[model samples]
Target: MTQAMSCNEAAGLVRSQGAVVLHTSPTTYDRYVSGPGMCLLDQTTEPAWVRTADSTQCFVGYRCRAIELEIGQ
Candidate 1:
């Protein structure tokens, strides 16, 4: 987060910090987190999106927040 890193680095960080990463298109991003263990890190404002490098119709959201992944009891 404080420095540049690859996807693997980010994934490792997520695993270390007990989190889950969800990649989705504009239509599916918000809807995909409905299940338990998934929470929007910040709900006070609308999430932001960053376009993919290929210029494809895909983007990453919630990158700046701490999304928590909980486990089922």
Candidate 2:
């Protein structure tokens, strides 16, 4: 229900809040974090690339994905 944000704005949220749920689109969202420390024991941090109002491929922060999936890649 909110407007799309800039890369800086999205990156700032992770830096300031440590972890937050970010919505790229009305129906698409994911949990982003400042670092791996914020991820679960069974999860690992991965680069979060998203389209923002100002950039197409913005590196906002990291996303928490399954550790096994990360290793498998």
Q: For each candidate, how many residue pairs have backbone atoms clashing (under 3 Å)?
A: 0, 0
How far out, in Å, is residue 1 in model 1?
2.8
Candidate-wise lDDT, in order: 0.36, 0.82
Clashing pairs in 2: none
lDDT of 2 at 40: 87
- TM-score of every candidate relative to the true structure: 0.27, 0.83
* Predicted candidate 1 versus true structure: per-residue lDDT over 1-73, tens digit per residue: 2123344443344445543444343354332221224445443222333234333322222334344457972
Which runs in model 2 stand beyond 4 Å of their true positions? 1-3, 69-73
lDDT measured at residue 28 in model 2 versus the true structure, 0 to 100: 84
lDDT of 2 by residue, 37-73 (tens): 9988998888888888888888888998886655557
